[model samples]
Target: MPTIPSLSGLRGRNTRQPAVGRIPVPMSAYVVDCAVYVDGKRLPRRFTHADAIAEVRERGEGFVWIGLFEPDDEQIQGIAETFGLHELAVEDAVCAHQRPKLERYDETLFMVLKTVRYIEHESPTTANEIVETGEIMAFLGRDFVVTVRHGQHSGLHGLRGELEADPERLCSGPAAVLHAIADRIVDSYLAVTDAIEEDIDEIESMVFAPNSPIGAEHIYLMKREVLELRRSVTPLANPLRRLAEGYSPLVPDQVRSYFRDVDDHLTTVSERVGSFDELLTTLVDATLAKITLQQSTDMRKITSWAAIVAVPTMVVGVYGMNFDFMPELHWRFGYPLVMAMILVACLILYRTFRRNRWL
Candidate 1:
């Protein structure tokens, strides 16, 4: 097995802290594999931007994968200029927070893919919910691959590791690299889907149980999450579909089938997202129904109490009228009798309510 740098140990000097004032990072590269099996001593040297173009021109046949993470805008422009990348594609890659998708620009193919990591944070509650956001952009050419992105993208890291581990895969060219990237990206979505579904299951249980612990705000936030997920992944389907159907010279004949497999994976993700959206809608409805029912139950109790108290209120009102001919007012047991009558009326109302199943 070919040895590649371990992701867990690849300590970037600048990664621990943000770069100052949007300065462009200088480019870097290292060789994972050098020579082809058939081409004996003919090995392509790994090089950075200006050198990469020169090296490609010299060799004129082998493939290359140049990945950039949180690169400076000027450096990105320089790479594009060196490789003759489309201006629009370069601009899109430089722009942050773009949805995942693939676009063809004449000879080159531009693909924007989401890279997600499940971040765990301390919480008062037992476990923390995942915090997710990352992106990877690839500009695929006939003989070279350029990937640019913001933040620490694990998907890209995995692809690099895979390439390093298996030299044969590196020789598989642009299409294989694209497939590796897509597979990792799809795996990210699967992770998110699993978390979301788990949340859904919790919400479902809460729906049936009276006085659920999960709050209304949490469910609404979850709905918003699913909506955002749909927004990010939906645009990606068409590009993957095109690649799967073998639309370009970049995607190899052997690997087009795998791209189709990736397309199916995204299709499954899309369908699940749709179903989750509906489940979220149902959760909202169920939450509202539970709240309404509880409120109605409370209101009935208050109204019933008020109705039973009305008799005592009426009796006091009549006694306070101070009419000399009133029979109860002149009796010795008048005050006690009035208290007794009020108590009796309360009991009678309580029994009536119990009989009617209104309590």
Candidate 2:
């Protein structure tokens, strides 16, 4: 990492120390990379913020693209000021919890994107643990592009390399950068939905399993996760459509076409997520129904056994009443006869209960 001598004073005031054996890294280290590109080719060496701005101002042929990762306000304020970014958008960029959106502030186009990477889990009940999120805010100006990223998944290192690899594609100017970022974010949505489908399929199987079953608890949780995924991607549709179809000078015609392709992909992912949500609802309802039916079956079996026990209990109680005139107490053989009658009655009740499918 390149040390900015200008930040040395701030470094001295750092009273908060990190963990044992670990040195506190300067916030300026968040500057992932800064480069000036002309006619689609990257410049030979690195340039500081001032130098990069000066080069673009002096030479109208190229634009400067700078990438940062989770930078603090004090660190990004200077860069934001240099690029003439709007205060509201800059605040959002620093704070980093904005929904996916696109807004125009004067000549600059500000866009917020939510990026997701799927987390692996063993089962559906844990679906909320399956998606991780991050934010990428891109500010597009005539002579420069600045991207501020927050969270673990929003880094653009690979995208930057790929964009550099094909200078022809990148020559589309600041709009190209916006298109690439949108494309990358929407692509991630598709990948996450694909992974989630496997878990959904497993849930469906468990719901329909023969004797073994999974409860609605997990299915309800899975619905919440799908709902979260929906929230992240659904709001961007209108913004993207305006970019693709509406009149915006910052986004050029050719770039709009690329954005249209992205819109189509986002639509697909959105529909799939909706389907997952609906499927989860249905599965939960079915599981509840199954549980109710099982309970009813158990109650019937219990009631039948109680009724059979009552008959024998009544017969024994009557014989034990020490009345001298009792019908079965007069003869010695009468006692065995009464016991045989009790056995016969219990057998008949058991057979009747079994025939009714209550046992």
Candidate 3:
């Protein structure tokens, strides 16, 4: 085994710390190899190709975890060939835009998972900002475990750190690594749900106070954001549902408990996303209803005022007629009488409107 090199700083640290004894280091920006456990002791560098393959061929035990970061197609193909994985799985691994999914090929299992980290400060939902979506396509066959991802994912990093801290679980076998990965992905879903719940609270407030200037852009943005999140995360249900049903051979009997828990978490997440869609729909309806009510109120007020003024104008029009035979036209009190009549009519109409609560 090679001497573990010292790392200046590890990510996800609130405070800095000095290097310790033997530390497993990342091979490149694209790959990390770790020797899980050997001979009842956790080695600094766990296993290689020969060691990993020999264990399955010989002792029928042990596990190897190879984390791939932003790997090219050639490297992916090479990994597939090395591990005896299917060509279709390798093709899917190289593809960037696949939704969360899973497949079984011979003795191997290919699982594509999505892990999201919410940018709460930047936007309302995971869709509004660039989330750290982890494309964790793992090959869990025999004694080897390979996880390929597109970029640096905090959930993956955290899982690896946790397994390193407790070598017993990771060293237990390949199943342990699969368990850790599943657990971490589920945790990420919970985190995203928290952020979405906060957005729901904001939407609730807006629903009650519909007059408070929530622009069209905001509604459009909210609708689009939730839809994007729904699209990205929903496909995962297929894979998880399959796993929960014990469809994958790579998933052990003991690990099924964890997978079941993950299934529950996924169900919760799906419910939340559905609720968010309903909330947005309600908001749109409420906004439109408020606008319509305001318009109707304004029109009623205009009609009421027009009726009040029409009474006085008609009285004046009759008195101003040029007919010589008109009695009120020649009378000394005619103008005053006509003016009083007009005043009485307006007063009566105004009082009637007020009584009817139409003023």
Candidate 4:
């Protein structure tokens, strides 16, 4: 095996110092971490993208893994050039919001995965957002794996540490890194799905409760969130399936089985997400039905009251005409008799309405 260059020697040769008056911007601003791994153990010294790949290729026994966070096109251009990443894939990685997918560009496999986090709130009925989404795009090569993240919560620092802790797994090469990333992403899906299920359950109970304050709008909001989740999750299924079935040479047979496991977990998440969407739809219908029933009940009560008032209104209207030959107008007990009749009629109507549960 060829001896790798010392870190100081490589840095001195490759790194350009800035002008004295100008403040230098380090690569760490966008390059989260860059390292070379030999036999699954991370090299102790840090390296730039160019240096890391050079070291890996020169040694011919290790691979380079580089991670970046929200890098612009200019910032990523050098790495793109160094790795021979396709232009389209580079563009998608720079300007994210691409759907979850897997594409092949010569010897490289580019895969995009959506990351989701559940926003916590007191109640689903009152929360404005239930699920928050992010993106992770991975470029897999025979001896290099590059990850670009596009959201605040989509950090992979912990994942890097976890992989480093398990050298046996990491030694499997760049495919191992790709598999770990996919596995971690699907595990996130599982967690977010569990949290969403709880929210759905809470909303379901509130929707069915007697005199519930829950509205269709709240359910609609949740449904909208679930729809967002679905969009992020559903499209990746085919990509994972293809990887499991060996769609790319970059992913070896061992990694393909792991991809299959990730695919199975993804399938579970997809099914749960689908069920959440359907349940939210049902809740919306139930909410609307309850609203309609409440409106109908209110109208019945209003109509019943109007009927009770009509009797006195009609009697008083006749007396108010001041006609000369109105019946009982001059009778000795006419006023009391009219009062009794009005009271009796109102009582009968009230009792009938009460009996019918319309009062």
Best by TM-score: 4
Q: Tell me the tens digit of each residue's lDDT in model 4 across 1-359.
A: 99987787786474676867845556789999999999889999979899999999899888999999999877899899999999999999999999999999999999999988889899887788888899999999989999999999999999999999999988889989888988998898899888888888988999889988889998899899999989998998999999889898888888899989998998998999999988998998999999999999999999999999999999999899989899999999999999999999999999999999999
Per-residue lDDT of model 2, residues 1-359, tens digit only: 98766765677586676878756555459788888988888999879877997997898778889988888777888888889899899999999988998989999989898888888877766545777788999999888899999988788999999999999977888789889999999999998999989999998988888885578888877787788788889998988998999557888788999989999999999999988988888888899999998999999999998888888899988877888998858798998898898889889999998998989
Least well predicted 10-residue stretch by lDDT in candidate 1? 31-40
Listed in order, each prediction's TM-score against the native is: 0.84, 0.87, 0.71, 0.92
**lDDT (0-100) at residue 142 of candidate 3?**
66
Write candidate 3's Cα lDDT for 109-131 as tens digits: 88887667666564342244533
Candidate 1: clashing residue pairs, number: 0
| lDDT, each prediction | 0.73, 0.87, 0.71, 0.91
Total clashing pairs for each candidate: 0, 0, 2, 0
lDDT of model 1, residue 351: 89
lDDT of 1 by residue, 109-190 (tens): 9988876655543321234344366777888887677877676644366556666677676666777778888888887787
If candidate 2 were superposed on the true structure by all CA atoms, what would the RMSD be? 8.0
RMSD of each predicted structure: 11.4, 8.0, 12.5, 11.4
The window of 10 residues in a row where model 3 has the poorest summed lDDT is 123-132
Model 3 lDDT at residue 41: 42
| TM-score, predicted candidate 4 vs. hidden true structure | 0.92
